[model samples]
Target: MRSDLQIQQDVQDELQWDAILKAAEIGVSVKNGIVTLSGTVDSYSKKIAAEEAVKRVKDVRAVAVDLAVVFPGTIDHKSDSSLASVALDALKWTSFVPEERIHLQVDNGNITLEGELEWQYQRDAAFNAVKNLQGVRSVINKLRIKPGPSAHIIKDNIWKALTRDANIEAKNIIVETRDRTIVLKGKVRSWSERSDVERAVWSTPGVLAVQDELTVSL
Candidate 1:
C-alpha cells in the first residue's frame, strides 16, 4: 500500500500531465487514499478534467471535487435561449447521441437533461454534447435509462462479462438483477476493479441502472 503523501503527489502530477487541466490553478490534497481537489478553473469541463485525472491516478480510492468554475466576464454573454439553441444544435450534430429522444433545458447556463436513453453511453454522450458550450456553467444529467425486461438474461450476461474481464475476480462478486437494475455486491482489490465491473455491466444492452455495492478489500 502507498502512503497518503505519495498518492497526493501522483494525483497532482496527473493533473499537470492532462492537457485540458490548468494544474497550477488546482489544489490537491490526499488523506487515506481519498484525493480532494479544491480550486478554481476557467470552464466546467476543466473542472471535470481535474477530477477525472485524480480518479485515474493509482492508489486513489475516491475523489472530492471542491473546485469552482470561474468564468471571465467576456465568456458567453448570449441569452439563455441562444445557449440552449447552440447546445441543441450540437447534440443534433453528434452522431452517437439520440437527438430526438433526450430533451434538455438551459437555465442560467445550467443544462438539465431529461429523458430516457437506450444505453449509459448514449446518456453520457448527451451530456458530453453540451458539456463544453461557451456559457455552460454546469450540467445536471436527469436522464434515466429506459427500462427493459428479462432479469434472468441480464443477470447471466453480467456474470459472464465479469468473468471474462481478467482484471476482475468474478468469484467474489454477486450479480443480482431486479427488473432492469443490476445490483453488484462483492469485494474488489481496488477502486479501479470496481469501476471496471460496473462498466462491463453497463455495456450489456437493456441495462437500466447499476447499483454498485462493491467494497474495496484492499
Candidate 2:
C-alpha cells in the first residue's frame, strides 16, 4: 500500500497531466508512478507545461517526456539536437522569458532542459518544444516556475474547501484551480468522498468545471 505522501503526489501529478490534455495541449502517460509525456505542441511553452504538470505531482519519481516539435526539417543534426534547438528557439523568442535563464542539452534523441522562468507558462513552453521531436525518445525537465499571487489564492481556496469537508483528509490530497476550473487530486479511502469532493468543488461559486483525479484505495 502507498503512503499518504505517495498518494498525494500521484494524484497531483495526474491532475497536472489532465489540465494539459483538457486544454488540447498534450498527452501524458503515468505508469508505476513514472510519468511519460508525449504529443506535438505549437510552442516550447506547451512542452514545459506538460512536464511541470507532472512534476507538481507528489509521488512522481521522474518524468520521461517524448513531446515533439512543430517544425522538424529546419534543424537537422540528430533527433535530440534538433529538439533541443527547437526548445531553445521557443524560449529565446518568447517575450516572457529571458534567453539567459533557459538552457538546453541534447544526447542522441534524448534532450535535457534546465531553466528558471517567471511563470509556469514559460517553463512549459520549453518542455513542449522538445517533447514532440521527430525521433526524440525522451526529455528530462529541470525547470521551475516563478511564484505568483494567483497560485497562492488557488491553493488556499482548495485547502479550505477540502479540510472543511468531513469526508476529505487535507493531507491526502491537493487542489488546483485555473480560470474557475477546479481540479481535485489525491486518494480517498471511499467512493463517497470521491463523489462528495466533486460535488463540493462544483458548488463553489467560481468553479466552471471540476476535474477529479481521486483514486479509491480499497
Candidate 3:
C-alpha cells in the first residue's frame, strides 16, 4: 500500500508517461496525490487528451490540470488577427447578434472584445469566435449581452450538430447553454461520442466552458 502522497506521485508519473507517449508534450508534476500538468497543445481536444490519458492510469485519486492552452506558440500579428477574425466570424454568423452591437480588439493574440446582443446567443457567438483559434491566451468578453433567441439559436445549433454526427442522436441528449457554458445531459453510444459531443459544444460560438453529464449507453 502507498501513502496518499505516494499514490498521487505514482499516478502523476503514470499520467506523464502516457502524455509523453501520446505526444502531447506536457510537463507533469505531482505533490501528495495532486498532479499538475503544464504545457501547451494546438487545440482543446489535445488539452482534454492529456487529462484523459492521466485518468486512465490506476491509483490516481484526483487530478489538477494546469495545462496552458496554446497553438504552436509563434507570436505574429498576422496569426493573431487571423484568430480574431475567425472568432468574429463565428459571432457574426450566429442568430443572436445585433450586428453593429459588437466591437473587438486583439493584442498580440490576447483578445478583449465588446458587443451587445439580444440574448445568450450573442454571448455564445462571442465565445465561438475564439474557442479553438491559435495564439489566444485569454478573452475578456465585454459584451452588453442579453439572453433570449441567443439561447434558442444555440439549442438549434446543438441539435443540428448532434443529429448530423453519426456518433450522436439528438433525442437522447439535452443541451443548455448560457454565457457560452454548455451543460449536456443524456446518453451516448461510447466514450468517444461523449467526447465528440463535448467537442462540438466547445466549438460552437459563445461557449465559455462545457459540463458533460452524459452516460454511455453501452
For residues 99-171, write the lDDT of model 3, one tens digit per residue.
5677878776667767666554556566665655656666676765343346667777877888888777778
- What is candidate 3's local distance difference test score? 0.64
Local accuracy by lDDT, each model: 0.86, 0.61, 0.64
Among the numbered candidates, top lDDT falls to 1
Cα lDDT for residue 157, candidate 2: 65
**C-alpha RMSD for every candidate:** 1.8, 12.1, 8.3
Compared with the true structure, what per-residue lDDT tens digits does model 2 show for residues 141-164? 777544334545655766778789
Give one digit per residue, the lDDT tens place, for model 1 in 4-122.
Answer: 99988888789889988888889888888878899898888998888778867777777899998888887656688999999999999999898899888989878999998888888
Q: Is candidate 2 or candidate 3 better by TM-score?
A: 3
Q: By TM-score, rank the candidates, best first.
A: 1, 3, 2
Tell me the number of clashing residue pairs for each predicted model. 0, 21, 15
Rate residue 205 of model 3 by lDDT. 57
Q: lDDT score, residue 122, model 1?
A: 88
The estimated TM-scores of all candidates read 0.91, 0.39, 0.43
- True-structure lDDT of candidate 2: 0.61
